[model samples]
Target: MKWIPQEVETYLSAKEYVDTAVIPVYSLSFGEEMKQSAAAFEFISLLTGYLEKQFTGRILLFPPYTYLKSEHIENVVSGLSKWEETVVQNEFKHIFYITSELDLRMFENKVDGSLIWLPSLPLGNMNEPQKIEVVESQAKQLLSIFTQKWSNHE
Candidate 1:
């Protein structure tokens, strides 16, 4: 389920079964690093969308948790901590934070949720079909990770 109103309504109706929340973390930047930032955004957005579709009834795909690339890592972690508290309070059993920013991995243990750091795959040159194929491939790889987390909780 996505963050859109219609999907959210569906989620509200069957909240019990939606035990996982996936939040994509994006590091935005302007000037010299703009292209890199955009690539990461596009790649992660597509990847998470694919994941949501595959696990539709079981996961809620939240909007990307975006921050400037120049921001301090401690601040970013602090912000994510707040999000973690809210999601946990709302009864989500699993929280997965997906990001292309490698620095986030260093602070993964500081946050309660699982942090999945995927190196950004440049998708700017790929055609639509190729983009889908790549995203699907990456999402397929993620299936086992998510299922493993679910099994552990169960």
Candidate 2:
């Protein structure tokens, strides 16, 4: 499931089964690191989309949580904490924050949700088939992580 209206309707009717939320964190930049930031966005967007399709009714793929690369880490964490509060209040049992920004790892424990840090894979040059293959492979690896968390909670 996704955040779109149609999916929201489906999710509303089956909220009990859709207990997980996946948020992709993006670091936007406009300077020398612009290209790197774009690459991270592309990789994470694709990966999360693939993951959502694999578990459509079980997970809701929220929009990307984007922050400027130059922003303070503390501020970033603070903002995400607010999101967590809202998500929990809305009955999501599990929340996963996926990102390629390594710096976020240092503050993972500060957030209630699981924080996943995946190094950005440059997909700008890959052909469509190659992109799908790479994204699928990464999504496959994430499947176990999500399932394990779900099992533990249950």
Candidate 3:
């Protein structure tokens, strides 16, 4: 399920079955560096779409959390950690923060949930086949991590 109206309703109706929240983090830059910023969002947007579709029932894909590229990352990390605390109290035992922004790893230990980082990919120019290839590769890694997490929790 995603952050859409109907899905959110469904999620609310059955919160127990949907114990995982998949949040995507992106960075926005102003001016000359805007191109890279856009690409970063597009990359995670594509990847998140794929993951959400495959694991809709067990996962809720939240809206992208975008921060200014120039802002201090520690502050962002602190904010995100606080947000995770709220979600944790809501019964989401497994919170997965997935992103293409490598800088986010700085506070991975501080966050109360698992963080999955995939190398940034340029999704703007890719053809259909190329996009599928890239998403599949990244999804393979995610599947492994999720499998391990679920099995261990059980």
Question: Candidate 3: deviation at residue 58, Å?
Answer: 0.2
Predicted candidate 3 versus true structure: per-residue lDDT over 1-154, tens digit per residue: 9999999999999999998889999888879978888887877888888888988899999988778878899988988888898889999989888887778887799897898887788877999899888988888789889879988897
* Model 2 spans with C-alpha error above 4 angstroms: none
Residue 22 of model 1 has an lDDT of 99
Better of 2 and 3 by TM-score: 2
TM-score of model 3 (CA atoms): 0.94
Model 2, 39-70: lDDT tens per residue?
99999999999999999999999999999989
Candidate 1 contains a number of clashing pairs equal to 0
- Stretches off by above 4 angstroms in model 3 are none
> What does the lDDT come to for candidate 3?
0.87
Instruction: Provide the overall lDDT of each model, using Cα atoms, as 2-decimal numbers.
Output: 0.95, 0.95, 0.87
Better of 1 and 3 by lDDT: 1
Tell me each candidate's TM-score.
0.98, 0.98, 0.94
